[model samples]
Target: MRQRSSAEHRDLCALAPELSESLVAWWEVHGRKDPALKPWMFRADGRWPAPEEALDPYGIWIAEVMLQQTQLAVVLPYWRRWMEVLPTVEALAAASLDQVRLQWQGLGYYSRARRLHDAAQTLETQRWPRSLEGWTALPGIGRTTAASILSSVFNDPLPILDGNVKRVLARLKAHPRPPARDDALFWSWSEALLDPLRPRDFNQALMDLGATVCTPRQPSCTLCPWRLHCVAYAAGDPNRWPVTDASKPLPFQVIGVGVVVNAAGEVLIDQRLEEGLLGGMWEFPGGKQEVGEAIEATIARELREELAIEVQVGEQLIALDHAYSHKKLRFVVHLCRWIAGEPKPLASQQVCWVKPQSLSDYPFPAANARMIAALIDHLRADTLSQLS
Candidate 1:
């Protein structure tokens, strides 16, 4: 790993000349074939796709918001469905909150959905943002996001520092650690360094090159347009260019969720606190795991702490594995029988013993969704033959 040094940044402005021609020429020949680098105007097979003329300002704005922390493949269907439902800002403004949130399920990052719903109001009759600053003023539009919308949607020359650009610049600049602390410098360099002759295409090309050719791991620098000018490739470790400190270990949060079943065979569940990690969602009761504590003990302590009822923690019902953006976690749910104390909602907003069939009506975290689905399927097996 290359150590952080002042020499890395020494007047790179002069040594690394702006190679707009290098990038544009590369895009002309090899770029059209690449899906990642294919701009809105062009398709991979050299077909011209006229999205701008077909898409209005409001549609483009909505597309930008949904793209955050979400993959292109995943966002496509949702985008189409959303556009059909709310063709204009006024349509989204008039729709109910629950209407949008339900379709937004599985995308994660609830706040983005909330803000996009809110921002639709401001953008409703206003002209499209002519500059980066204007785009940035919109709700949920951060610096990079604003830059991306301006450059991609409006065809402006604004630079983008999204995950794609971050990956590319990490290798180009060759730093190590999460780049948040150095973002200001990165943004300034991005905005200033591009060859202005083709700012829109150049910025988009860089991001495209970063995503496909100069990827996060095992970047195909040989196929990269910027490879000829990239200092990281010359340094013999192109993969190591975007440098950052090693990742902090994923914190383990162990908690026991209650699967309370009564004589009616209804399983008890609770609506999670609507403001924290799983706000406005439903999950079983649980808390963080203490170091060196047994699962049973942890469950007992969490029950007393969160639900205020004593319970006999039973066998493990099932284990669901899930990975979040920042951490990997396992949700181990257990079968429990409440022995004493009246059933009450202490930590949750509401509590209910939902029938096994009715579980599908409530929204659960992606991780919890697996266990809930499996349990419902298992319960339906016996009744299937009788119904038929």
Candidate 2:
């Protein structure tokens, strides 16, 4: 681990009293009132309607995975729709990859859906994992996610070191370094401060406090339950507690994206292999732009390499700039005419030709979705023009 400064060391070394009463009290007043916010529980008040139905392991697991990089407000509708469509582990396991991806459309991280599906298959056969080790052994469930599930369902005294908890604890400790830099120390503090008696409420309260009060910007210190206990607040700038080095400029890549349309007015899309980024999601066939290569040349070469076919690059459809976590991408999309051999799934999972209007039935990454929209609009305009 990287060395922490003297100030950082002092912030992390002290132990706070494990008093969660005030936090829990604050939660009762200001925590998320929606029952769906905590997926296992059926009621917003945290009261169990019935022991059997109160805790849906399947629902909680799905929610946890979706909630990984997404905010609660954004995931609510998606969660509700997902539950309505595929409520049980058996249902999820039985779902087709395309079906799962379609349901998870616009969720941003497609790999989570793929892993969730794989884990669901395992759980459907053997049943929900009882222990943290058992849960973490499954796909996509990490220490924090497993802890969240266990504590929420079984009231296990496991500590969660999620982003929210990290922020709250970092501020409380006045840690002058990012929590990610010293996770071991943060985990230790989390474990020490966890309320063993009411672990569920305690964990939820801390999460709520971080999200609602101890936010990344303009934190509501006056309303925070642990305001007095927060060392960063004492220092007078709570937002600056979890300090990070200046961010480096993200690298940019120019990519050639092709929207190949056939005479039947159907678009060709390929299923990505079930690994790496955007795995199992469908995308317009294209590749990275080689140095000094023209965008059209890059598209043709990529198509030949990927699908063993040839395409005549036609009108430029759109040029979109999208950013991933580490890099920026400039996708120069074009309306391509399929000229030679039949496109094959040589490098992808599968290749398909589908009507442009029915693209929603399949799942595409956010950038691909933009390409689809632009194609649809262009087709509509052409149709109106021909009619006129």
Candidate 3:
């Protein structure tokens, strides 16, 4: 753990209490009259029907789970897929662990996906449990996950203690109190302080406000509803507040392999089997890069290692940028013409050459999608240039 500077400590330390005051008032003014926003809600202006069926429980669950260490923008696609595949507890409960894994293939944190599967199965078999406690008993249904589910599905106003919300509150209170990574302390603060009457709306507002206006990098203080009450903003060092810095030195690696092919215009792709790092997905042949080796050489080496085939590295295509939960990746795709040797799966699981027309038959890793598109584009352009 990196040590926080004294000034940074001061900024973060006051975030919590400050946040509590500000958000409370903000909620009082802007809070919805939806019980779905709170525990057992009320109706001031007949707003009860508004939160009926949040229609986004699955998206909310997937978002919270995928957001473990990932960014908001990056989680969108994965969330959309999860939504389409398993929109509700009932749908998710019916899904197999393997199917869930496939749907959540690129979302990282495989355990969350697995837990969701188990929880879904449990949800299906067991009776519809009402309280958050009952929901929490299911696998992967943490306090935040349960809150999101209840708020989105049942519109129960349970305080959602997500990271963005924690950061917002921590900064608002100028809290020097260290936020436990597992979110225990934050959960306590959130639940206790949350006005159960509008837990759902308040939590969602906090999350949205934090992600958008009360941002980590550059907060839009002028537009914030809680601007008047924010102590962190008053401290003139909002960014330093919630001094949570578990920075990891990004590990760099290289992948070298060809979009292998046969004379029939079929491309050979391998379904990655490695667990925990973009597992169970197909990719155009390649693996990690070595020091001091040119990308072309690395490509040849990777082909020999993974596919056991010799290839003449041709021209270099565009570079594809990709980032997983744990590491960053830069894939330098190359145009390669086959040299020799029959295709044999050595490092990868199964290897096959499906025609370009039938490329959609296999499931490739999300990172490889760009590379595959680039590969096809490169081929098309080369053919056009030749014809010209």
Candidate 4:
């Protein structure tokens, strides 16, 4: 929305030419050579066979979604697996939620996977988004994501301001305060420095520069191509350029997880609603530890409340710690024997009794997954002892 003649635009105009030229040239040599960005867009000869070929929008959209709040290194394998499994938007749309969740089991943010499926269905009804506005209108696609997709796939000359780009721009300007305070300035600066001729390569180069060189910790300024143009480097403190806000203590919760198993060795699991954190995933039926209640009592209460059934809470199975983005969790997993009544989905979307061996087919959160591992190990050892 910012015009090139604006005052903020004028401030960056003088540096824009040199910045874009130098940055793109540097990218030619140091830019990430990974095909993760758009593997389908390249050829075996290392050059684009069809330079004008429209990129696979589905792949671009998937990569952008996976990359949100996640590092590229962590996303690479998941991206590869996803592409192999759900190569087309229509395939993703047709895939069951359970299958999608299984593929995204360890990806931390389960909501992204949900939105990806939702958006894939939406794309089937409509068409693959060709413009930034169209892309952002889809679920989970924000301005940065939309811009990245549009630029890389459509060569739309759109500017992106992801975490990496924000850090790079903030340091380039030597912003003494958090860039979030003046988002307009950072966005405008990113636009001013965008190279329209090669938007895809230019944006990728900028992201790589920030991720590899202008890191959050000690930046490799000496090897950086933009060191001479960086206001932060000139000020002798690149790390201080993007001013950091005071950190807040993350609140912690004590959870009680029940590994309820029947005589048939089937475990009780519940499906979370498709809304909040870890939505649409199956988990061992349990809840937060209530105040003044013992861990065992908490498990009994959670089972009674969550499922319309009573249980006898047994010994502790596993005690593990997990940290989410906003809260830390201390999960005290307990073995349990199902008793009294039949289990039903009282507070969850659904409930099921699955065999221990088939638990891998259902998607569970990281914390619940750990509990499953412990349960499997205990069951395997018990079987061995009986055989011996």
Candidate 4 accuracy as TM-score: 0.93
TM-score for predicted model 1 compared with the true structure: 0.79
Model 1, 150-204: lDDT tens per residue? 6655566676788777767667766655666678667755765665655556765
Model 1 RMSD vs true structure:
4.6
Candidate 4 lDDT for residue 13: 74
Q: Mind giving the per-residue lDDT tens digits that candidate 2 earns over 340-386?
A: 88989988999999998888988899999899889989999999999
Which pairs of residues collide in model 1? 170-241, 170-242, 171-242, 175-243, 176-243, 176-244, 177-243, 177-244, 177-245
Error of 1 at 173 (Å): 3.7
**Model 1: CA > 4 A from native:** 1-18, 28-55, 85-87, 124-131, 175-178, 195-198, 262-265, 290-315, 336-345, 382-388
Which residue pairs collide, candidate 2? Answer: none
Give the alpha carbon lDDT tens digit for every residue of 36-120 in model 4: 5546445445564332545767777887888898888888888889989998888999999889999899988899998899888
Instruction: State how far residue 53 of model 1 sits from its true place (Å).
Output: 6.6
Error of 4 at 373 (Å): 1.3
Q: Which window of ten consecutive residues has the lowest lDDT sum in model 4?
A: 42-51
Which runs of model 3 end up more than 4 angstroms from their true locations? Answer: 1-124, 127-141, 155-157, 181-183, 246-248, 338-345
Ranking by TM-score: 4, 2, 1, 3
The C-alpha lDDT values of all candidates are 0.68, 0.84, 0.68, 0.84
Question: CA shift at 59, candidate 3, in angstroms?
Answer: 5.8
Top TM-score hit: 4
